[model samples]
Target: MDNRSYFLEEQRCVKKNGSQEISAHCDEELHFDIPPTAAWGTTEVQLREDLTEERQETLEDTANAFQGRGRVVRNNTHFCALTSCPRILQNKKKGKMGVTFRNSASEGSIFIGKRTVKDGECCGVWDVAGKYSIIMGPQRKWMMFSRFIFMDRLIADSHQYLEVRYRNGKKENKRGPLSMFEDPIVHESIAVMNAVTVDAFEVIVVYSEDEHGNVKRNVVHGPTVFIPDVNQWLHVFRWHGSRGKDLHEKVPGALVFTKLRTIPDQFYYNAEGVRTADDTSLTVKVMVFFQLTNLEVMLNSTHDPIGDFINALLADLMNFGCSYSYEQFVQNAQQLSELDTFPVMCGRASAIGFTIGKVVYRGYAASTQLQNLCESAIKTRTELKLKAEEQEQRERMRDYEVRGAHGRGDAERAEELAKQEHQLAMRAAQHQESLKQAEDAHSKALRQKEQMAQVELAAKVAEEQAHLAYLQGLKDMGVDLTQYLVSKSEKQPDKVLKVVTAPSHFSALPINSVSHIGGLNIHTNV
Candidate 1:
């Protein structure tokens, strides 16, 4: 690893026919129509004359072989149809700006020209020439990052040092040994983006290290499932998706992936025992929406502040909960995801969590492989969350009291209300349990239906295989089914010529269709 710090940059380029062949050699000769070295993610940018242009690095998603008759799909709204995308195509049509993970957009046209730039600024622009989103469907992804690289010189490395590290708590007292998730496992170079919230959010420290074992922690979240602060997480709600078969599932058809949490409309928080706004006895039921995304995680309360803010407030309130357990993590996610409030009896207790810090996003050289890492992060988040919940339940049975200034008598009436509030909450919890059971049943039914469909598909494929075998057997016996099935008055028909002009083109051939082709289909050209 180089002792000096290295800056990773992402750039955009479009490859066209007759252009220099770009196999795996994109690192050597690449032309950038819009080098947003100073444009992407910067507050201000000006082109450099006194300074040298920044050298950016972009990982190759798909290799360049030649394929003819490529068509462009514009304005595809779905995204999942693009996920698991085997590869992305490079379109080098002049006047056609290409789509890329690096953000670069023109001030005039979406795909026309480069926006203005400054020397030290890394431009945050969208690669907008309507490239299809493989996993997300036809909707292409725009570039998002904290910064880009500025270079005075370009020194190509046969292999540069890239490492990944993870930290659970504060940066000052970082814990754990550095682990590497590299090459095909961690595609798409690491880039940083700013988070809106700075308070107590759960943060993971991540970054690539150099070959010399020198480590850098620029990335805060990689393979981390938990996102703190609803206000900062960037999220997409819904999109379409495609399958393994070459058919568009969403319209203009494609696979789509959407972020569910970023921009929630409303947040729900329970207001069980809090005093009314007027200080008189008042009952209020409200929905609290705790919205989170790649940028922000914010809390919005309805009439009941406790309903909306409790989960976040509890992070500061109940500090005894452990992070190692799933119950704690889930209780945190639920409390955070749910709404909560305050101004209750000191004796009353509620489990809550907060936004300790930032969670980073990282991937292998190929973004597709990130799914395995993503799946692991997701599972870890869920399991730990569940453990936290069970621990919270045990805490409920404990009793405690706090002094309210100068030995003054605590409000007995308030204490009574708090006890009843706990009972009310217990009843509500029962109802929630019932709701969960119904959901489980519904999910099971869906799984069964899907399994049956797969079984039927397999049966059909197998039947087709058997029939093909029988046809070959007949051909081996010197019997030509095509001649046998021809018109009774006809002489030997030409076996070399084509018959039944059109054939089914359903990616995987339908075995049933072949059965209806009459005896002539049995004449296999063994």
Candidate 2:
């Protein structure tokens, strides 16, 4: 609390002490040796004493103004002591030069510099030093970048390939399972295209440039790979829909046909309100089958083969149907399924490189009234035929019965005739036996009569011989033969006979001398 003022010179002090003496207060300087690693290195610093009174007063007044504030104020205007510090010295360290780029083996980018590099090659410090750029050339110009393109399995199996077209019109083909970047020519390629795959049953027509650069058409068969050149392309085929009175809408489309095998197709047609010869209206439905024979001829002859078939078939059906009445057509409807019914269609098909296989008249449709009438007529005709057949069967049965009765009667009459002939033959045999026995009895009686006559003649001859001998002996004894004859005549008087008609002169002679009396001469022993 003592308020007083005092003054002190340099290097001296005034104190409360009784005697005056020399003061130790003086301006001192301090030196600090900072190392190179610190912010400031190898520098000197000085500490100054409070020597000015005015500066002290000014500080005292500032302190009095902020006496009750609880915070201290600092002056940082001269916090740094160095006058010119070199800009914060940075450490000098070496680093890598080039930017890193990463990519897969299947993918790649073009880098242009002194030389081109691709196919997933790495770029290092040496590349950057050589001024190489990715997908860029000198002056940062854009360049071509390509990645690996894989062919599909189906295409590869079919022997298909890819064609690379160059900017100079040079063409080259590459097979599948390859990368574009692997080949150096890819850098100069303008485009790459896949080749067309041909199957076993297919064919293709193409327009291509020949060796002389002239465009010409050529046909390529199946089972091969068709790689077109830079100036080659496939031929486009357009198909038109069928057009006819029976068709309501035209069908339009594009298709490629198979030329190596047989192709089958069918179509239906209807003829409405068609009149027959008997003025009967009918709706006829027709179906047809066709096959392609020659493809070149078909292309040249017609634009729509199916349309031609329908038209031709319709014409033939109309001609045939109109020629017959309703009844006649019904009887001959079977002819419709035959090939002869569609002569016009067949001829047209052959001309247009096609063959018609079969034609079927699906049948006809008529009004209800006409159908009912036809059914009635058929029923009546069938009934009449059945009745006639039954009558004929009855007549045949009656004729067979009559023939059987006549055969039985003829058999009985033959048996009766045989019995009568047998009886007549037995009677004739009995009569012949009786005649033979009677003739044998008459012959035996005649033989016995002949034997008896021969015995009697022999006895008479013996007696006459004996009598002559007796007469001869008597004559020799002088006996007379006349007496002996008389004696024998007397013994058999009945057998003796006399002659009455003698001469008159013989009667006069004696009876004893009759032998001489007839002549008038007797010699009797008189």
Candidate 3:
């Protein structure tokens, strides 16, 4: 028979061996070519007898018989068996297939002719024989078969973990460096978590739930990694300030002060429209440096430490502006660097667990009019100072000139006095030498006169003795001594003339009596 255009109905009755009747459906396509000997019957006994004779025949004879009739039995089934039996399914690979029953009301359960198969229970091929129905079957019940879901092995690293949730609403944490086969019972995997790592200078604050369900906090200091428990959470710090607005908005987690090292922050404060003691308005700019000291105290005390510092510094600067005059403030501007100037800031920092390291007075600005006036005053004062300095310098120069003139005069006077003293010394030496020469000449003349006188006296004494002896011989035949003296004076006429010019009247006594004249005392009376 050619069954190419034949389609089965919802409830089709087929007669087996011309006697037995059966209601059935065929899900697969049916195409058949059968010989006259392999035709169907209306009776079950005839169907069974035909199937036994076909099985007893040789395969080539059956195929030749079908070929002679211009038809072929592809599945080797006789026409009577095709209309009475259901199809069979087989698995030849390593995976699972899902067989869902259209008539079963519960999940993973199926109903056979007289038995039931539930979940987690194994079913043999025979148990599922009539349980699977086709879409066009007598009951119109359809079975849906799912494709294979391959079993695979999962691996996790040391820093990774898996969160598994079951069909029963139970959760489990699977941490690794390990490999595990996928359990058939697990429903799904929720997430994969990696460990948080920190350096030696950092720490992490974590909040977790305890066994009693109470929330607890802890600090983790590292050079290490931190793997949080399934129920634990990390602490996030949020800070807001004028300087940090954009930074905080973009990366809020960066403000979490995990570092244990010292941190420095700067804030600028402008105290505007402040009135000085002299009623002068001023605007002062002050910069502040601050650091965090104790994290525990900070968390317990305040939410925004930078904001607190800014407010406190502004308050202190305003107070200072109100207390001092412009000049006083400028003169004592260095006082801002001292911690004592920021009492409010210091107190607030201590309360909020921060340390105020230093404050800097970034000078000040005033209204345009006030600035111009101050500049004018400064210019006038500077001009006056310059003029005074110039006059002082001129006076100094005049004094120097006068001093130089006086010094030159004194030097000239000193030189003149030195020259006069030298001349006087030379004159005194020359006078001394002349006096010595005169005294030496006088002494030599006196010595010569004395020697001449001594010689004359000796000669006179010798002559007088010789004359006496001659007189004694003249008394017995000698000449007179007076005649000898006259003869000696007559030989020297210049001596006679000197005697004549003598202060005595000895010229009148005659040459013969001139013995008493020329420094010779002869006892001759005339």
Candidate 4:
């Protein structure tokens, strides 16, 4: 447009219900670099290509590995295309914000912090505004694209035009620089454009960086919002970046961005059908990041960066009458917030004075509550485990006492048994002594009795001699001689002795009867 030329490539048709739709689009192909960090093996974007035979082959070579031009891909083949823009500074304080370089050092410990810049700030390498590009699929309707800058600057000077190019796979003129400044000056507030919606956007990425500088990526289907509305908020604003450990660490590299919502309102094509603005102060501080690396972006819903330009063309803005309102927050939000989020905005547009739907607000509230519950549950579990350990320690002390008592009882029983065993041994010795004394006494008594019996027997022998003399005298006298002689025969009528006796009667007396008849004999046995 520097040469005063005009051609419309993309336009917005405002739906009867106030939502905008892509009604008419020119058949076009524009190439933007596959950010070196491209998520889908798309290393560079082909925003605009020169239709040169040599360049075509190169394009094919670069895009050969890309699946459906990175709309989606298999496995980890998707990588976010990354481009390092030279630094530019706009800060009135500290220093300016401009492109800077870093040696891709493998060593850790090298971390860069945020560089702050203030208003009226401008710093691009002279005659070398850092070049940026994009590669995309061939589509008739223009969707939206996203960009991240290290810093921000408001466009105070007249304007700067965006150069664009496109190409088809046709080897013969298959690709070439499609157009430069396809639309007029975009994003910045030009006299002809509406305020771009550069505020309150979301960047969802589930991604991580590798030691070898590889990035794994996936695309997040973000909340749907009017693309132009997204662009207006993207206008030049301050950004802050920080590095820290996350899911992947030991050492981790991360850049989180915080942006100032600059676009301000719903984007529309302006009175000249070229620029846009709004009545609502649709702006807030929100940070955006592509948590997903290679979207395998089967469906990417990136917000428009040219919101103001698109809004200018919408008939509703003119009918609604541009009224402005700004709602400022008392505190800054560093993490993702639910207030005035995209989903909320979808159901209800919360201008400084707009009303919101109840269901949408409730959903956001529930989401926050769920996150809190998870955190609380984790904390509670940790506390309970700590308490359990304390109880276990107490139990150990109690068990120690019980074991000590059991050991003492065993020792006491052993001592008592030893005393009883000693008493039994003494009793046994006494019994043996008593038994020996009784045996000695019995032997003495037996000897005495034997001597006495012998003495008595001697006396009896003398008496028997005397009796024999008397018997002889009687025989000589011939008085009853026959009676005396018969006595001899009667002396021994055989007496039977009893040999068997009961054990209890072993020492009982035995008796023999004498026969007093003609030839009987009598004797007593003890």
| Candidate 1 structure quality by residue, lDDT tens digits, 1-526 | 2122112123323322243322211122222222222121111111212211222112221112112222223333111110122232223122323332222221111222112233222232323443322122222223422222211111222222222222432111111222222111223332222222222343333334565767553324332443223112232222222345532122222323222232333422222322222232211233332333433222111222223343333332233223213324333333322223222311122212222121111111212344466578879988998889778755653422223332235567667788999999999999999999999999999999899998998998898888778778878999886875475446544343334433456435323322213325334422
| Model 4 ranges off by over 4 Å | 1-410, 413-417, 424-433, 436-526
Total backbone collisions, model 4: 99
- Cα lDDT tens digits for candidate 4, 383-467: 9988998899889888988988998998899889988998998899889988888988998889888988888888898788887
User: What's the lDDT of the predicted structure labeled candidate 4?
Assistant: 0.32
**How much lDDT does each candidate structure score?**
0.32, 0.53, 0.57, 0.32
Q: After superposition, how far is residue 149 of candidate 2 from its true place, in Å?
A: 16
Ten-residue region with minimum lDDT total, candidate 2: 26-35
Task: Check candidate 2 and list the clashing pairs.
Answer: none
The lDDT, on a scale of 0 to 1, for candidate 2 is 0.53
Top-scoring candidate (lDDT): 3
1-526 per-residue lDDT for model 3 (tens digits) = 2321122221232324435334343222222333335444221111122222112111112222232223333466433233321111112222222343222111232221112232332222212343322122122122223111112345568987766677787777778776543433454544566667777767678888988999988878777877777688787666543345432122222344433434566666666766777888887777778887787888789877766776777788778867888889778778878899889989999998889888888777899998998999999999999999999999999999999999999999999999999999999999999999999999999999999999999999999999778777766655566686677667433222223354465556653233444555354333
Per-model TM-score, in order, reads: 0.15, 0.36, 0.40, 0.16
lDDT of 2 by residue, 285-379 (tens): 77778887887787679877766776777787678778999888777778988998888889999998999888777888888999888778878
* Per-structure clash totals for the candidates: 122, 0, 10, 99
Please list the Cα RMSD from the true structure of every candidate, rounded to 1 decimal place: 52.0, 35.0, 24.9, 32.6
Cα lDDT of candidate 3 equals 0.57
RMSD in Å for model 1? 52.0
